[model samples]
Target: MTSRQPNHKIPETNIKKRIAVITLKSPAHLYHCVPIACELAKNQKFKVDIYTDTEQTAALIKALTEDYNVSCRIQILHPALGNRLLNTLTRHPARAKHIISHNQDKFRHYDCIISPDFYTAPLITTSEKNRPVHVFTFHGAGDRAYGFKQQLCLYDLILVSGPMIKQRLGEEGILDCTHSVETGYPKFDLLHHTAPKKLFSNHRKTVIYAPHFQRKETSWYDWGLEVLEYFYSSRKFNLIFAPHVLLMTKWRRRKSIPKRYYTSPHLHLDFGSSNSIDMTYTQQADIYLGDVSSQVYEFLYHPRPCIFLNTKKVNWRHNPDFTHWQ
Candidate 1:
């Protein structure tokens, strides 16, 4: 009998899916999504690419990829040279918008794009018919209105930490249950791995005053220095005045810290550092103080005392904008 010739077509399951994990926001947002890329890269059936806007972030990604023992190409997000100077001048959210505008064609080629931000899905030419699926891993489990912002409706999948965030997003009419997944804050794993930091040598209780950056909503503009002075003079407690890492990034004006604050052994002033965003201050502080910063929730991992500052005198009672207190 004549031998039947077998078809030479390769199996579809053998094809590796291309996934892009991107973070255009500040370093703080990187913790939310980089580990996810590392985990995804472990699967040989998929190819993962990590994209960032700054060398600072590229270095961070390399360190993390090595720490996690994962393999992935790190791509820097940049506009063309023609607009690179203009792009460098603008700040984030705007800079993020510019990158998306320039990279639409490049992004559309991926099978899946994973980010810890809302910038991607809204700007890219993504439609129901689009090839690449957009997944938004939340940068924070923050309590502020930004957490439940209207822009989140653009993504195909949204990851939430727990029931509180899920319910709040759902009630806002932005989150569809089908698109939302309760991922329970993966950065907690990062925090778990990080050793506790010691800010003061004495046994005095430590207070971390971490305020939000958005000047319109931040208490930093009106009362930040005053709050620092109070802690500086009182020496009763060691103070870590590390505002949200983005605070200085957004504030174009450089407010000089008094020489006294620098000399005070009780005062630990950190404008921006890896310790600021990695829950080092949150984990170590005895008390948490902030206006709208989300590190308060991280501090509550131990259920310590918290004091919220309402410098604007706005009624936050029963207000959805200040829903974390609820």
Candidate 2:
């Protein structure tokens, strides 16, 4: 068999007999699918592989490997790239054969390819030989804003967490495929497994502020500072700030984010980095605060008092399908 090339091209073949998953390194997103992937692997139902190109993926793989030995390959597709050109050149159709040559045996084994998000299209396209069932887990809740339609258009099955997503996608006229299914987010299975743990001492309260990073309409960029101040001085409570991990890496380069000081002995801030705490922090927090982040669902698994930040003028409170509290 010939080796894979970055731009290798081949006539599409039928290879969707077994399956594996392509994972985005984001913990929030991966949390929904990893357990399911593990279950699939454990049952020997699918030959699974989780692919990522970020340091966070490495950290997550390390953490998960210790807890679950799910007989599957965890492949690092490539290092972070400044642009898609290099990634395209190295892993796209031209180089696909070269890329899969080492894993040709493994690639040929799976029938379906799954991804936690739409960004993994190139990896799935390259790995599957254009034959496997390409399923994507889309976490976005609304209409196509950032090339979402294009990204989602590629999937054979679009796995979503809620009905709102399915309805929204339909509104956008994305009903061509009969594969959209609501699996209720496999990551929430993790939330279901979490027992109530003490996030702070009995003398201190705990608040969790999880913010989304959508800057075009509403983001926590400016008001985040105000939130830091409000929580820092509240000595009675310990604060946990877990912003959407995407915020940290969105800019072209890593910009120096100003440090906000909290004199209160009870404040803690986390930006979803390798060193950040897991969703268990959500279980321990007494109150939850945020804009529009799915982490809210993670927090509401146990039904805590949640205060939505209306900073961006999102009227989410009255939304009929806000099922987190229900």
Best by lDDT: 1
lDDT of 1 by residue, 1-326 (tens): 11112222223587898899989868888889988888889998889998888888888788888878888999888776657865556633337877778878878778788998877877777544454767788888886777776777766678788988888888887664237789888787776455676878899999989888887878888888899899998857989999887777634433456778878999998877788877888899999988887778788888999898888887889987787655
RMSD of 2: 7.6
After superposing candidate 1 on the true structure, give the runs of residues whose Cα lies further than 4 Å from its correct spot. 1-12, 87-94, 126-130, 176-178, 250-253
TM-score of candidate 2 on Cα atoms, chains taken together: 0.72
- Give lDDT tens digits, candidate 2, residues 1-326: 12122222223445323566655445555655667677776754345666554556655865665467656667665433433466576643213323333344454445666766654444433443555566677653433244246446656677777777777667655654335788776665554444545544557778887776778434476577778777776656778777777665544312443444433457765666533435677777889987666667667667878886666565555553343323
Worst 10 residues of 1 by lDDT: 1-10
Give per-residue lDDT, candidate 2, residue 144.
29
TM, every model: 0.89, 0.72
Where model 2 places Cα greater than 4 Å from the true spot, the runs are 1-18, 25-27, 79-109, 122-130, 140-150, 192-197, 249-263, 274-277, 314-326
The models' CA-based lDDT, in order, is 0.79, 0.58
